[model samples]
Target: MELAKMTPLAGLVALLALAGPGAAETFTLRIGSGHAVGPVTYVNTSRDFLVPEIEKRVAERTEHKVRLIEAYGGSLAKLDETLEAVEKGILDMGHVCFCFEPSKAMVQNLNYFIPFSPPSAVQQLAITRKVYDQNPALSEHFSTNYNQTLLALSGYDNYNVGTKFEWEKFADLSGHKLGGAGPNLVWLEGSGTTVVQTGIPDYYTNIQTGVIEGNMLFPSSYFGLKLYEVAPNYKIIDMGAMMVNGLLINNDTLAKLPPEVTDIIREVAREYEQVTAEALDRDQAAGIEKLKAAGAVITVLSPEERQAWAERLAGLPGAKAKEFTEAGFDGPAIFRSYLDAAKEAGYSFPVAYAIE
Candidate 1:
């Protein structure tokens, strides 16, 4: 009886040895965003595109699997705190909006400071990707200073003004307090308009309470936030599409991932950028239609007036370049490269910014 029991135990041990390396390891990734899930929003892209693609690709191409733990709508980190949270490893990944931390992300905010480039969402996305891929300094800044790796970049459609009053000419904005985020606020520097320095979340309350006469934002945000109910006038300024935010992974978490899994994440991130740009294009058109249906008056400034606005802000880009150069970045080279890319992409600016 003892010999028979010993033989079965030896057979069981042999069988266990043949089972290859146990099951594949499952790595859990926590992706956090301040934005909530809504139709035609970046959060939708994260939920419907980035997460699923990463999961599918990892399963198909690697022995490891990824389990995405999503924490959106400020459940993990608010918009402004996302970069810090990821750096501190509180979240594995996050969407960091450069607009929120302009001073720290000066290089990434290049698009915001240089207006009258490409207003097409696709072109803007392509230009930013191209610039970032070619410039090692920009990438180094993220990894060295922030303890994060940038996977992809995304942006909104061209900015427009939504106001309680109509805007026909530059002079029409005189004495009006308009709310805008940093850097873009400088676009109104000499237009006789007062900058409220507010963000999108506060636009509705500010406009409704007469604290601000209007807010500068894209059509998708204006429509999604239902700002037309209070600020019912829309002016299409076409102030160039901006690279607003990026998908970033904590460096420590990225270092822990398998090589194959890391490759898939990078591949899917490029696709995510394309999908986001396409979504912005679609949503802006839909948003415009919705705003019109909701009794929002829509108007486009004439070419002459648009050029005048561009000239008014022409000093901004060079000033920004000087500021960056003083801070040890090759700002003029980056600025020139961007303009060259925009030109190659078929964009003709109304006013040429003197970067040199």
Candidate 2:
């Protein structure tokens, strides 16, 4: 009899009978994320790319099977609590945005402090993955300090200035309240732009109420949030693609998994990085066109002014490096390695950061 003709129950019985003396062990992994599913978003990528690939690879390569329980869209934990949730074993795995917990995950926020490295999301992902692979200190900080294993690093397109008013020159931002989150607020310093610590959700209302004149955000977010309705001017400053978020597994949960399963998880996670990078690139292109159709004014800063903005924020990276060192991390070394990896990948910065 052909196995293909068997009923579902019959097929399961036959498979178990084929195993002879033992039944294949099954494990359940509960994965959580704060964000909801949306096209080209990280949450969507996790469902479409990471989870299915992991399940397929594990079943193919091992005697074990995994059942994934997804708890996304803040069902399990808020965005800020994701890292801690994974650390405390509330969830077996989760997506954590380092920008959300900058102090706790200071070392992981390195890319946010340094701007103007590269404009391409793929290049930025390569640079960050290289640093994480080569720099033991960075990976260790996640595993040892946070009790989580870094599965993959992913990022979005370079940020631009979304404004209610026209931004033809850098000087136009002087005395204007620019909305930014976490370390990016440092980018506006010394440029005479007063920083308003705000997040994506509040940007629209804030701009309409004149609470903030503009925000430093990427095209994907700008279009997704429909910020063009309020902030009609979009300045493509190419402030460098940022490695803002990561997927992590609880160290305790990882330790309990079979070695083959762990290996597959890590392998699939790397592919997740590539998948997300490509998605960001695609979304950015589409977003720009959408913004144009919506009648948003889009412009790119002149190369000279872009370089000048970089020069003005030159001191931020080195100062952040010092803070890293004082916090018991090799901040300067990681900073140098990040730049080196970027340079080796053919990325040239507008201003050379003073790491020494």
Candidate 3:
């Protein structure tokens, strides 16, 4: 009988026959993400690279052959529900964005609290990983509170400035209108720019129809949205290349795996972080070129001016550190530590914010 046409009982019997007496067990897993496959790098890389790479490594390195049942675009779980969904066993594993779980994973999102990071995804992820290694509670919370293991970390592309008009310095944005969803709003605080509460979907029409003149968003998103047609100027803010997305697996599912398989999965997951970062770096670079080709003017904010903008937001990071410190995590040290790590790695911030 064809494998696809076989009944459940027959398939089990056939599998046993093939294993013949000393075969290891294979596991089937359901993995999904709320965001669709294309727009979100985490979803795209998870679907194309992480899943298949795990299968290949498991097959090559272990006795078990694992299969992942894929679902993207919220087919299995919505955005904010992914972490909880995996916890409840509704999904064996899934990709999660901490932005959706503000209360649940607040400290995990320190990357956002302290902005003006380099646009390089590689550096963003490395700094976050170092912080995680220093602060065990950050990763521990996943298993301690959510009943899941964080297998890998993922980051978005560079968050640059896209505007309908050209501007040279931070002061140039004064009296202009811009749009952002949340958290990122503070980055524009000191500048007298009016911020419209809008999302990526509305950025195009909002700019075209005069609702807002610019948006603080990722380059790939800006290009993908065709905002260059309207917001034809790009500012290299390199605001926050955050490693805010993670791949998670339920502890129960992980506990069922043989040690060998578990090791392979974890190793592959770490590698997934690096490969996805490389992909984001490429997308960000390529997207800029595409934007220029499509008639967008690009400008790099001078380090001096960038530092001035960072100074405006210097007081904020400490406030966020307290929130985490009060939650019993080492927020202060980590915040300062991240800045130090960034500096040691030779990526200068516009301004070095202190964690009081």
Top-scoring candidate (TM-score) = 1
Write candidate 1's Cα lDDT for 40-121 as tens digits.
Answer: 2677889999999999989998878999999987898987889899999989999887887877787788898887767778
Q: How far does residue 51 in candidate 3 sit from its true spot (Å)?
A: 0.8
Give the range of the ten consecutive residues with the poorest summed lDDT in model 3.
35-44
| Regions more than 4 Å wrong, model 1 | 1-23
Error of 2 at 284 (Å): 1.6
What are the Cα lDDT values of the candidates?
0.85, 0.84, 0.84
lDDT of 2 by residue, 46-103 (tens): 8998999899988998888888899987798877889999999999999887877878
Provide C-alpha RMSD values for all models, in order. 3.0, 6.0, 6.3
Q: For residues 1-356, write the lDDT of model 3, one tens digit per residue.
A: 65657899999999889978447777999999877776567777888888998899889887788999998877988877899999999999888878778789888778888878878898899888888887777888999998999988896888888998889889889999999755577789878999886765467889999999998888877787889989888999778788888899999999988888889889889989999998888888888898889988988999888778888787888889998889888878889778888888888766657777
* Rank order (by TM-score, best first): 1, 2, 3
Runs off by more than 4 Å, candidate 2: 1-22
TM-score of each: 0.92, 0.89, 0.85
